[model samples]
Target: MAEMILTRELFRHMCEEQEKLDTHIYRTRETKAPSLKSLDIAYTNEANEAIKELQKDWKWWTLKERNRERFIKEVADCFHFVASMANQTRTVGYCYAAIDHEYQKVSRISRECYPHEDIFYKAVKGTVQESIASLIAISEALGATTDEIMTAFEDSLKKNYGRMATGY
Candidate 1:
């Protein structure tokens, strides 16, 4: 519970980078409208994928080992959708514009949020910030250090670029 090392500045930069991936995603593949609701559902689905990765160890009867790397990758994917969600709002402005007041709220909620401690199917009344909090909760639950999460994000971006190259 120490202060999160992932500062808002870094978070914004990460979002910008994710925007590149999202651009490729739209160009190389069909995508839902860049609407908040669409992004919210997409982000929630990615969160569930992260949970699926975490559940690899849930079945005591199985000998499967949870892959930290894959779980972190899924968490990173959550951010990808988050950044897209941000773009739909002029207030958040994908963290490009000054959101000092808004970010204060987002930071607090993101840090304190564990509203859904179980499998998250959908957000009842989700916003971009709430979705971000959920993503943070998943990262914390999986014990993924901020550094690891950032690295996974970078890797995901690279993979997205590769996917674009191959028409994925």
Candidate 2:
């Protein structure tokens, strides 16, 4: 049998876990509101927080430095929000389109705007999938890896489940 990069079953498991965590986190005393705007805002905030972790090492003079572990965990937080953004299970293809989007965003060139465009893809993906792929791109750019993300995400999910049990 050929080796699989990421199977649909694994993606489905992640989605199910995130849905449970989102349910607990989004519930309120009065009501629950999961508008796209809200999720988008949350994603941005998390991404910003992740950057702040890197900012420490970005400073030239200050002795403060980036904590690699914490930084990746912060990035993982962004992944958590992306996973919660209206859970769609229609996509599990390679991230060619998604990777291209990330590349163009940083490279300033895209097939959409130009015929002879730079591109590469191992799989197809959707909107949310693209967002996830972009995060992977960002992570790799910052010297992180998918393994770290997987560990951090699982840790976060476990922590959230603990919060759920605590009536939080």
Candidate 3:
């Protein structure tokens, strides 16, 4: 397998594009009010829904037997909301920077000993692993290749850029 190369510039561009699409879509539908605040609420709601889908408690029996598609879609919705939020704050770069920092920490730890002495380091390491697990789950559910996700992300960027400022 080849190494994946993701850059902040690409991520920022993608988020900007997604934001444009979000604005246009909301305006066209007029079903819900749209704003950065609304996007934040939507992001939280989607995250809650994703968590519910992953639940293995009593509620699990009530969910669809095969929820892979729904899970994938819900995750995608979360991403859309995140993109909009990041674009509004002009903080997509910060988000990518944090991801890269965490990635390096994980790589370093894998090559060395775990930081048993540092609670913060251990917590960061665990967070990195958990984040990877979530990504793996999404990829598995969607049956998506890395290339496919990349292509879809790029396509989204293009479509978003072509959309009207209001998401029409």
How accurate locally, in lDDT, is each candidate?
Answer: 0.60, 0.52, 0.50
What C-alpha RMSD separates each model from the true structure?
A: 5.3, 7.9, 8.0
- Highest lDDT scorer: 1
Candidate 1: segments with Cα more than 4 A from true spot: 24-33, 56-65, 93-131
Candidate 3: C-alpha lDDT: 0.50
Model 3 lDDT tens row, 1-168: 112233455556657768667676667666543577777666666655654554442143565453544554555555566667666777887766655565454434432432222322232133422333343333443364544544656654554455544454
Worst 10 residues of 2 by lDDT: 115-124
Residue 31 alpha-carbon offset, candidate 1, angstroms: 8.3
Q: Tens digits of per-residue lDDT for model 1 on 58-130?
A: 4446666767677778878877776666655633344433333333434454356533332232221345454
Model 3: which residue pairs collide? Answer: 23-166, 24-166, 24-167, 24-168, 25-167
lDDT at residue 113 of model 1 (Cα atoms): 55
Compose the digit string of candidate 2's lDDT tens values, residues 1-168.
211222344445666678777666667333474676777777776665665565543344666676667767776676666666636332323333443444445332221322111211210122444444444544555555446667787897888778767877
Q: Which residue segments of model 3 deviate by more than 4 Å?
A: 1-10, 23-37, 56-66, 100-144, 148-168
Model 3 Cα shift for residue 168 (angstroms) = 11
- Tell me the TM-score of model 3: 0.50
User: Which structure is stronger by lDDT: 1 or 2?
Assistant: 1
Q: Estimate each model's TM-score.
A: 0.66, 0.62, 0.50
Clashing pairs in 1: none
lDDT of 2: 0.52
